[model samples]
Target: MDVTQFFKAPSGPASMKRKMAAEPSDAALKRLRNDEDNDNDEFNGDEDDDRFMHGDGLTEAHRNLLDIVDSAEEAPATIDLPTLKRYVLKLEKSITRNEEMRVRYPDDPLKFIDSEADLDEDLHNLMGVSAAPELYPNLVSLGTVSSLMALLEHPNADIAIATIQVLSELTDEDVVAEASEEGEEGMKALVADLMGHQILDVLVQSFSRLDEFKDGTDDKQGVFNILSVVENLISVDPTIAEKVVSSTTLLTWLLSRIGMKQFDSNRQYASELLAILLQTSRENRLKLANLGGITSLLKAISIYRKRDPKEADEVEMMENFFDALCLALAEPEVKTTFLEEEGVELMIIVLRERKLSRMRALKVLTHSMTGEGGAACSNRFIDALGLKTLFPIFMHKGLKAYKKAYKSHSDSEEDEHVLSILASLFKTSTPENRLRLCIKFSENEFEKVERLLELHEQYQARVHAADMQFERDRIAREEAGGYDGDEEVDAADMRYLNRLDKGLFTLQLVDLVAGYLCTQASEDLVREHMAFLLNRKGKDFDLFIKVLEEYAENTGDATSETNSERALILTVVEKLQIISSS
Candidate 1:
């Protein structure tokens, strides 16, 4: 039996089939081949005759058939809207009918397989809705969504798989954003309905049934299909993604699935989904961390840490693992988990020994150390004795060489991140750790401080040029009558302030190191480095004064750092003045 003939609305005259089977006229052949519009006069058939209408002629039994046939001729033919609504009704009815058949033939399981397969094919045909997602409004109103989601938990796995296939078709990624409507109402309405009906729970339930240990063909396809549907939903709306992570066992399952060591697409997809979920929510990250996710992630990537994966997807999977670990480490609670799992040791091993995951490890470490809530992580670094390894990498000529090779400031972002990490580490340091940091940099004739000064000069020049350019541009805009308002000026000013402040943070870090050496180190060490610190170009003195003044204005005399740092700055000022006088 022809499958296309199985499901369609009735069309055309009954006698017309015989006429169509007969040898068509030369005119009919020409029209059928190219759909060319030839004048009616070219054919000798009378206009008033019923047959001349070519099956569209008005008849007592079916006058509307002609209009329906005309509409069906449009390209990429779909069942008409009314017929589609009726088709949805049939799909809803088939679900109940299939359940009844399963009950009736309880002993003969194969009896319902063919019916389930046919129903699957019917659902697959619904892909035509992509071109006309507007049709989704009516289908959703008819409770087709509820019926389809119910099948995801059917006793027969085949029925569940078929439902997944249909859901994937409805929410395909490529068509979600391209739905042509006023504000994409079609796709938005479809997703809203899916989410509102808790499709996440249904989809996750389907995913939970698949066993990766079984190499069965159906099981593998089902896993792939379910992942695709979940990806599509999350890609369309982030709220759905949050719901997916919070509402299901998916995060825990993905944590296990990625460590399967199979090197298959399923493992690769699991890695990707885990990264997306962790990045989507801090709660998701914390949840995964609580489930021993950080350990699982480290174990999976440990294989490829020493060398690259052979396949592109495997490499991507590993990178996703890296990304996920980075996001998880941002949470303070997860940082505790990291300590328990010996995560610092793992990252240090990657940095010190592994070439394949070296850059990625640096990024994870940087994210772990830098930022507002990383004081505890910074303390962990000290307790782990990470400085023994970190200082060598920072002072290596290779880092400076890499910084010099890039011309664009943006290209040096990783280098800046490294600097930020160091600054953050020092920001939360105790007196003992600060002295230890000073001793580490003073090795090899103070090369680290010299490098820090060089980097500070470079960023200072960039910041100065940026500030000058902004002023010039602001003047130009005002001269051309292009000053929009205070909002635009204020926004631009805020951006400039951020750039200036970032530049100053690095410079201030250098000042901090110099201040520590002056206050905490022996007098001989401060004297030895005094000229190098005071004599650089790029307004180092002005920046030092600016930082000092900001601290004074923002903090009171009661602040411990303010009082201590003020005394250190004054002492450094006297040394610089004495050097200038000499």
Candidate 2:
């Protein structure tokens, strides 16, 4: 006869099992009554017998047990509107009692400890609301949302942590997915209410007070729960990512946290959150740049520049930092900041070191030296003697053996990034640096040009195979009457997309690099080496011109910049055509 069982809410199967376990069997109760009767006979007194008997020929204790069992049987099996209201009422009372006790006896833990424990239990019990997220609006209407939010600033860290756990559970993605359309609307209203209550500001401020090392597990879990809450909120409303960085100290806290020397779960989580925020909006990216985020990320990731991460989690953290840096570098202003912080030099060192960071560093360089904003980075890259490192990778030298010794890496992926670096230099470099680039192809007996042609053939074969497949699919579809009479334009568009997907894009890049070297490099040597390679493959300059023509035709809108790039590529195509005619 557990009194706790009388108060327990009718949760699902688990609660049923607990209720059955707590109840006494009928035989056990009968035996107990018989034992009580024997004891009564031993006492042999009317007063004792009268105290045990009731008017219905049963003991008063046995009748009370029957009443408890009846009430338990009559309890609602699932949470509905009335049950939710009761839970809310219970929670509100617990919160009020806890706050009152804390206020009345601020200096005495003993006086308020029981109330604090009760409040904590109530907060956790509220997590059952997540199962009925469609009722979130009702929870909000009951005014407990504010009470729960206020607990984020509670004087007790445990209370704040418990509140975070509840919020995290409520906003969880699985819960959101379980919701219907009406439930989604309810979730929206709930989140809107939380935002109106300054949720982001409160969450950011909590970071300073919640020390993860203070109580070890509890505090660590508190910090993790806080991150989960933020992640859940963002998942519910992606636009909150911009609001998070724009309106609060979260970005700043994240930057400082990840910059800490010691590696921990919170630090890793902070890095991941930072990456998510930066990837959300251009405004977020620009904000990071203004805050010296580039410098901070560089310092944090520099630890692994020469060495690999010790564990998989650290590897993930390092990748997050790199991801954040690359996203930040998308902004022109951040690219400038990246260059000013000697980011190009660091990347070059990373490339030369050939650590796990090498491939990612190459990706960062490709981003840094892309588009019109990358001119300065391109110049700084050459000025830093980055070519000495770029060429060997371009030629695929020593990479296979290194890949075997350390980690398996994609040779094609390495080739793509290296070729991208070269393409960027061709597009963004000054005349002097452009000559320096062309000389790299010439200095190694046209070795770079030869490698370029080999890649061209390789990707050309891939594109050819894909084109054949597309043709076969098209023929089958035509035979089967799969095409509408008016879908010729649509069919042509799909073919182009299929080609791009199956190496046409990389093939265009290869041809673009070859075109650059053919026209920009020394006329006799590079053209001859390229022509000799093409001819040896039983191809000619016409192949390069065809790829270039196709590339320029699809080179996007005819904006002045696009027109200029298209004009340059067309000029290269014309040159190749003339060279072929000769």
Candidate 3:
């Protein structure tokens, strides 16, 4: 029967017709949604009162009818086929109003589906049809789904497209749930079936529509409907993604849709859906090595990334797009394709200088190293000093990102690069494996430190010279009988003294000074910096405390003083439970 015929028919499932004499009538639906019901605390409400009142929503007449039906219910009510079909139509039409209607008829949908005897066997047969390939050789089920997919090919294009959209949105949850319930073996079967059949047909037909599609309106509804269908089908059945991507022919169609020259709404959605398809199947990773896919996609993203840097959604889209594209390094074939097409230089350029693209590159690199071939290729690139250029960025706080965070205080917390690099490092455990990762970053950093030390000594002598001048001036001023107020010390000298003498404020300068001693081991630089920054500036007693008690506890000093610093350090270590008991 035509779909319209089935809708108008008087016979359907067994449970739908089985309303008892005491069942609540349609008016009860209005009672279910009324404000009084919501306030009554049991969570029942008038579904009609929903904020978005639509023409297709539950009308007062339908609620009264449901109230009449509910009032008639009694135990073991026998609903006839005729009455069941009527209720089925009512339920189907009321679906658009579902967010509200489900609340009103809470027991009906569950009871209607749960009982095997109550449901139409044909409707239930739609469950995971793709799981058994022999079952739906035509790519559409015989009853419910067949009727739905057929709607896409209907002559009334608007009606067909709308039907496809509604059907996809409406049935997607149930289809996915059914596939999930079957588990992996069933899922693989379902994916393979869709990959071989329905997926190709949809792409071909959708692409064909582009020729006739108009800019203003002829294309919109159909394009959106097509994408919605595409999204629904692949979202739950990712196995088809590889099939769509690996076919060089399908790849060309996708490229033509949203690559550099095309940026319309349909193309935009196509790009978005393409991402979803690859992401779900992880086929996107493969596409990075696919001829024309990566280069074209990145070219598109470079433009978008630059054009809408401030638009958070665009940034997120760019992120997902590249991340999936970068998964190319996984297969040796794909890796070769990548360097051959774009080369190792592209990876470094993206990492070193491309604004947001660097993050996407890191993400892809992380995935690439996840696979054996990718790990080896990435090692070669790094041995060439790619990582050396990037590692310095992680050492300095708040220096990694040039873009401001849309979220608060996240900028102060930690570097994204540090987290990214650490994640990449954790993949391997052996030192022979990890040593190449060190990038000799500390060597150059240490050389810079030695240079800084010479400057530090020069600075110390200048400060001491100023102190001597102050002493000379003080004696001369007093000798003159009355010291002129103009005997004020230079601003620079006073600033230096304040920094040297202050407490917590001096810690900032101490950290700068102690950082020069970074070549020491076991996080010794951080330890020394923390302690040295804490030491009192220019006080001989405090200096003795630092040298004898904290700095060189292994060496006994020639000058004798009480070792309060050592006691304090030991106390702190004990409280923290860092050292073990004998």
- Find the candidate with the highest lDDT and give its number: 2
Please write out the lDDT profile of model 1 over residues 336-420, one tens digit for every residue: 7877787777887777663556667777877777544566677777777878767766665355554464332242454455665
Model 2 whole-model lDDT (C-alpha atoms): 0.81
Candidate 3 minimal-lDDT segment of 10 residues = 11-20
Ranking by lDDT: 2, 1, 3
Candidate number with the higher lDDT (1 or 3): 1
- What candidate 2 gets wrong by more than 4 Å, as runs, is 1-83, 406-408, 471-498, 558-567
Question: What order do candidates take by TM-score, descending?
Answer: 2, 1, 3
Scanning candidate 2 in windows of ten residues, the lowest lDDT window is 12-21
> For residue 579, what is the lDDT in candidate 2?
73
- Give the distance in Å from residue 412's predicted Cα in candidate 2 to where it truly belongs: 2.3
Q: lDDT tens string, model 2, 291-369?
A: 8899999998788877788888888889999999998888898898898899999999999888988989999999998
Please name the candidate that would achieve the greatest TM-score relative to the true structure.
2
lDDT score, candidate 1: 0.65
TM-score of each candidate structure, all chains considered together = 0.71, 0.82, 0.46
